[model samples]
Target: MIVAIKYPNGQPYHDSTHQPLSKKAADSKPVQHGHRGMSLEQELNRANEFYLQRGIANIHKKPTPIQIVHVDYPKRAAAKITEAYFQQASTTDYNGIYQGHYLDFDAKETNSPTAFPLNNLHQHQVTHLLDTKRLGGISFLIIRFTKYQETYCVPIDAINQFWERRKTERQSIPYQAIVQHGVLIQPSLYPSLPYLEAVDHII
Candidate 1:
């Protein structure tokens, strides 16, 4: 019995019983999805600048507090931050006065198709937003679905309800649920996200 091993394509090795195997066809190239290169933060910053320029609002992203541990002063130039750590966890991304109300919110981006994972939010962040709401501030979340290029302004009340329900229900909030409860925001030429237009509708 001339037992033999061969390639999956039945191509065999040397001894004249062998024949070179034709190469397999390469896999088809994947389709590339177009994406906006600007980040949520950058868009919000641009929007805030436009708001400021038009005297419509005075919103700004909160700067993270960093404790400088060491600094290298290369004389004649600016001192370089050699070592530093965040002083404290920042509460929210942006906050300021709009009209006669106080606004507080955090911007988030997700690529999830079915849902926005609550994991994107922190316990403290939730608490801060809720507390802001309690203190008569308009607290909300500016969330963007990167895959869909859609943004929404979700009021803290709706988020709080979801957070409270998640303890005994689904861990993530479905995109449809957000669509039902949140205000859809369109990106524009001036204010990139135009979140305030949604805010105006809500407030």
Candidate 2:
């Protein structure tokens, strides 16, 4: 029989491990929500900015890129570009050095109570994460169970299982499975992701 487990905080789990497991790993990137004056993404970006200002740590979302196709030699010191194209993202959303450790992670969100879709993840991200792990870097995924208003820190080892089981449509990791292997996190204004706390528990 498939057993159900619940954490003390009232979240459900898959079994004894307490990390949520699903077929899909990281699904669509999660966007911040519900700040009247600002978009959720804007609010979180501001929070990230504030954290950077406080010198608590240096972590920033990866920047968007634009390709240059045409240029005009306008001056001796400057050139003007006439054509450009937006470039696809090459890495996970957020990454940087924290507490002398190299940190790499991505944020994803799903409204599903049962699963966090694997469709949210990309092949390149899996490759990047694998490389980081080999180099002794701290690599993980940040998942937001939007329905429950809960977030979790999922490690790569658990993530790899979903990667290995890629032959089926059961892609997204269910919230119950997440509760099995992942560490629950409650983000706050001051600390933002509060990943360090989760990292402490995980390592």
Candidate 3:
């Protein structure tokens, strides 16, 4: 059964379907130095679980509230959601506490190799991060460049700097600027993406 999901603004959400690559085709692809198969969100979820098991941190992806509008009952014991809409715009992707400090952050992926477009982030998200920081909480972003398979933990201050400059300057933050201002998170086996090490720097 197919499900129709939409945003609060009535825009339909397009869910991209992925086909598994053949073993021969997968072998032909160039080796990625970083985590290749899993998305940034998946890696983070795995890492968060690891942290929870180790008592290292308590972080989780914020669940977007959905308002179900339609449901189909194909069987007496089964019901499938046919249509749903987001209850409201989300504040950020992930949030929780880390080592006595409140941590709030969002994860974003860009296919571009040269820059991270400011348009990728919404104004409300930026405001939320700033507000979190103002309340003495650690707020930041985990940006992954798909082309390079590189991820960086960028502090909110760095993001705000470029966000303010976009009014009269370039609309996107240069990759070099991210490399300078953000800490590169190296992938690991246990937690997969060890972003907390980068967070340690921010703290």
lDDT of 3 by residue, 1-203 (tens): 77767566555565432222334644485345445588888788867876776688999898888999999876533466789997866588899989999999999999999999999998989999999999999999999988988899999999999999898999999999999999999876545698999999989
Candidate 1 vs candidate 3: which has greater lDDT? Answer: 3
Give the alpha carbon lDDT tens digit for every residue of 1-203 in model 1. Answer: 78555545545544541121122311243223222577888778767766776688999998888999999977555556789998767588789999989999999889997888998988889999999999999999988888888999999899888888887998888999899999999766444477899999778
Q: Which run of 10 residues does model 1 get worst, by summed lDDT?
A: 17-26
Q: What lDDT score belongs to each candidate, Candidate 1 first?
A: 0.80, 0.69, 0.85
Candidate 3 residue 105 C-alpha distance from true site, Å: 0.4
- Measured with C-alpha atoms, the lDDT of residue 90 in candidate 1 is 52
Q: What TM-score would each prediction reach against the true structure?
A: 0.79, 0.69, 0.79
Model 2 TM-score on a 0 to 1 scale: 0.69
lDDT of 2 by residue, 1-203 (tens): 86545466545553332121122421344334333333234434555555465565577788777898998875443455679999877777778776777878787778788988888889888778778877987888878777776778888788878877876647678788899999987665332445567766665
Predicted structure with the largest lDDT when compared to the true one: 3
Candidate order (TM-score): 1, 3, 2
Q: What's the C-alpha lDDT at position 87 in model 1?
A: 75
